[model samples]
Target: MLSTEADSHANQSDDYAVAPARAWFAFVMIFLLMLSDYIDRQIVVSLFPHLKEEWGLSDKQLGALVSVISVVVAVGSLPVAMMADRFGRVKSIVVMASVWSMATIACVFARNYSQLFAARAVVGLGETGYGAAGSALVNGLFPKRWHSTLLGAFFAASAQGAVLGVILGGVIADHWGWRAAFGAVGFPGLMMALLFMLVPDYKNVVVRFAPKVQSKSPKAFVKRLYAALTHGPTLLWVCLAGAFELILVSTIWAWMPSFFNRFHGMDVTDAAKHAALVVLCCAVGALFWGWVADRLSQRSPRNKLLAMCVLTLLTFAVFTYAFTAHLEVSTQYALILLGSFLMTCSVGVTTSTVLNVTHPGLRATGSAVLALFQNLFGLAVGPLFGGIISDAWGLDVALAAIPSIAILSAICFWKASRSYEADMALVAAVLRQEAAGERVENTAVLPPLTAAQA
Candidate 1:
């Protein structure tokens, strides 16, 4: 019996050790796709001044253009994620990338406000499921212990994409034209979609979620989703925390270029350059914090949750000072960079938390739920609310006030910390049962366990 157990452990270890080269290559390809995804989504923001001048648009209208995508993405995420779960993740990703790429190309032909808005909505439709499905796919490719660090790096691609979008969009718009920026950024995703087909699927890759459910029915999917959302007290609070964080993040991403252009008297290109630097700082922060969370989580899951709560408060304080203080331009920029970095620290941690408590069958759906809250409350409302406030008072006042939502976020994350360990243990119990060759339903409910018991 001892030899048998040792052999089992050795085989598992060998499996993990054999697949580094192919696994990392697939990871890089998927990471690049995510990078392209954000570039297409964010490129429009860099053209805000040009769009406002040419279209005679109001701040509300410009903000609406950004918010509408989030609204669509929020509305579409669940259904599309379900489709990915029912269908194949690789196939769904290819199709999604293709659709969004085409929609972005359609932006080049948009002659007026309505046409552009419609195109952007379609872009959102194509993008709605990509994040959830992509993350789920990444989870299947990497070891469980690496989820936070790798997903953090994966998600950090958004910041890099944003940086590229703002900087390259501004430069391209200046040199070629705003329409050219759309075409230039949009075409790469299509080629990447083709390249993605060559990467191995979950079966070939050998890194798969243990004890996965094989259900595919819509009813089963819905039930699994419901189970995932209600699996523990922590999921809802974590989702809410993420939503609030995105509220601050979306506002910054949507408005910072304009903030610099207006307040610092920089040209559009120069303003985007500065904003890009701040976003790069955010990317670095996401990776740093994710790595920190992974290391701390090695000691206890509560440590990562506590870290998120603390970072939220820190983010709020720094951002408030950046916006409200009458500091010098350089000083304010420094503060904004600091605040942006702190604000993103929770990205990977929250994602890993959700996945930790969720069943493998529902990970994509779980991710979609988080995205739904984030988009509906954070992405959809944050920018539009800021726009309204800016119209009422000024842009600076709007930024300062909007980020105070982080206080609520900190509260939610803190509350979640209380229940996280127990919930994780519950998930582990279910996975263990399934690994023991017992048939497990998606909606199987396990009795609660206390933290001490866990």
Candidate 2:
């Protein structure tokens, strides 16, 4: 049992009951920061041509520039998230945004490839816990009813930001230089970080899972974290299912432009735009499924698992045929668009599910754990595996083969469905106990930590 909301919000008051306007402001700022985070991360993709021309780099080296960020972010997320949980998300975000933004701006002065690569790694480090912390912030601020929908919108920002990054990077580079692209995207993030300071901080929830005497101890904290993360079947399966879903998403998004160029005879630019359109469709699907999931789960929390299961099945069916049926180019692209939408059904669902069962005090850390799985197992594996398959059997075969992963993801959701209700109920009880305990303490002679009071 670990959760505490605002003083104004009673134990059962939807956290939004107090200062709803402030919650909206916080969400808006966090949304901008999320957009800026991905934009900085992805803007480099569009600069590949510029880098290759200026430095005479190979494709492999150019690719590493992007891959390194994912690796660093995957590795760094947990520790940063732990610190965020202990401190405050707003302050941590301010520091992270400043570091990453300055690092991105620093790329403009890079002397060579190594310098640029190092700067990108710093960007990853800064971004490590942002998603986790942001998700926690928004989820805690809103009530359970809005969790799926708002989280859906929050997650959609990543796809939207990536699209903006590519388009803005290319456009800015064409007008100015590749260096200017980094500066353009990075500066706005720094300014947004400054504005974020105005958002109020949620009252820090101490770890109720630990004994009060040992609550702040590092060893106790780690043990409690491990227990929370590994305690239930829901978190484990949902994480794996989400990772598998991303394999489908990342494979298509990374290689589809080349797939079209190679198989359908579309030019590079048109093919890229074509892929972007599919991702935009995914963005839409995330919101739609979020709504659907909320409606289905009104009776029981576990119904959300069924939504993800159906979504993955739909993705598998659509992608398998689109890639293998030998259809017309237009027909295939249409199916790919549908597949894209279907694959994103778990975006908000996965994170919201994680938060639902997690101790509210550990919400941000729980999100980081999910982020770790997604970045390391899902995002990292998808594009690389697709490339490996492309090298052997060709792009069409690779894309067609990847849909089989959706079957595995669907299986995971069904397995998760078994225990989700139990796990969610368990955590809700814990939250209620902790919330009531706080009320008792506050009523009983609580005192401030000050020399004068002592």
Candidate 3:
């Protein structure tokens, strides 16, 4: 009987393999849902000029519309992700997608700034849980070797969605009206949410190798949450690095259309088209850099962190040149494209780092914690602060200054590299023990690394 049970365990471990078609299908569905999430969240940015002109709003007010969503998403991600961990990820994602889609459609009916603001907040509420849960689900479907590549590709959906949102919002708003843009992008998410219900989850496919201990008590839940949050010192530095990098990312996504319109004298649609191209570059960069990081990590894990740090520094330099150099319009666009591409290289790598250092059960919550810090410190503040600075000086000055945050981000990533190997080994040890049917107590705490290890 013991031999049979052991054989079953080994077979279950092998059952991690899924049909390529099914895996890709699930990937596409989740990717589309994520794409829709960003489309709903970011469509407002493309409407900034329209809203500003119609309402006679200031840049700060326009920026606040974007910031409000990030603020709410930052606050809501933790609880919503916990729900995903406890309940079902797929069901949670469907509900989330529906809520955001409905909220986005509600934007079409909003009559005043207050109404629109509330609608945007609801959109945030729906989106806060999706990324973390979606990433966790995708991770479970594939082997760890593919984590960075797949997650990088998965996260690239954000840039792709943002590109579509800005472009479609601009084109539709130009032809039909800004309100029509909202309804156009919002409805597809509802359908996508329903379609997502058909995809299978990891629990259904993979039989449990280790005993499943679903934490029923609040105390056990708290302990798990705490462990997830403090899994390693590397988590803190990675989150901080990602947060700092996002300041630049958020600023660009939020204001690139305005920047083109103001500086290049392009129309709304034209500006959006150009910005969409830049965002496409960002998507490509995420995949390219993620692949590069994974390859480098195969050589040595420390190389992954080094790659992020180097990419960030390069991004900063290119962006500084793009904004500060008094160059031709074509040259500026080329530089912006290069800068945008480099800026996203860290996204997949950082996400993979967080997942690798934490326990499997805490994957969604771990992602949520990363999102919480990234949104709160980066997304919430970047655009608003940039807008305020733009109002005081000029948008050009704001763009120039924002890239400097990459310097800090690079430093944090470099620091993280120093501790990453030790933390990774610790996580591996714990996972191995768990695989052998040992319960790991205080799994979050690792023994201090000796000088030799360092």
Candidate RMSDs in Å, in order, are 6.4, 5.9, 5.9
TM-score of 2: 0.86
> Stretches of candidate 1 above 4 Å error?
1-18, 204-224, 228-230, 440-454
Model 3, which residues run further than 4 Å from truth? Answer: 1-17, 204-224, 228-230, 440-454
Q: How do the predictions measure up, each by TM-score?
A: 0.89, 0.86, 0.89
| Residue pairs with backbone atoms closer than 3 Å in model 3 (clashes) | none
Q: Residue 452: error of model 3 in Å?
A: 30
lDDT of 1 by residue, 142-249 (tens): 776778898899989999998999999899999998999999988899999888887765631111222344544556544444554446888889989999999999
| Candidate models: Cα lDDT each | 0.81, 0.76, 0.82
lDDT of 2: 0.76
Per-model tally of clashing residue pairs: 0, 0, 0
Model 1: colliding residue pairs:
none
Error of model 3, residue 79, in angstroms: 1.3
When 1 and 3 are scored with lDDT, the better candidate is 3
> If ranked by lDDT, best first, what sequence of candidates would result?
3, 1, 2
Candidate 3: give its CA RMSD in angstroms.
5.9
Candidate 3: count of backbone clashes, pairs at least 3 residues apart or interchain: 0
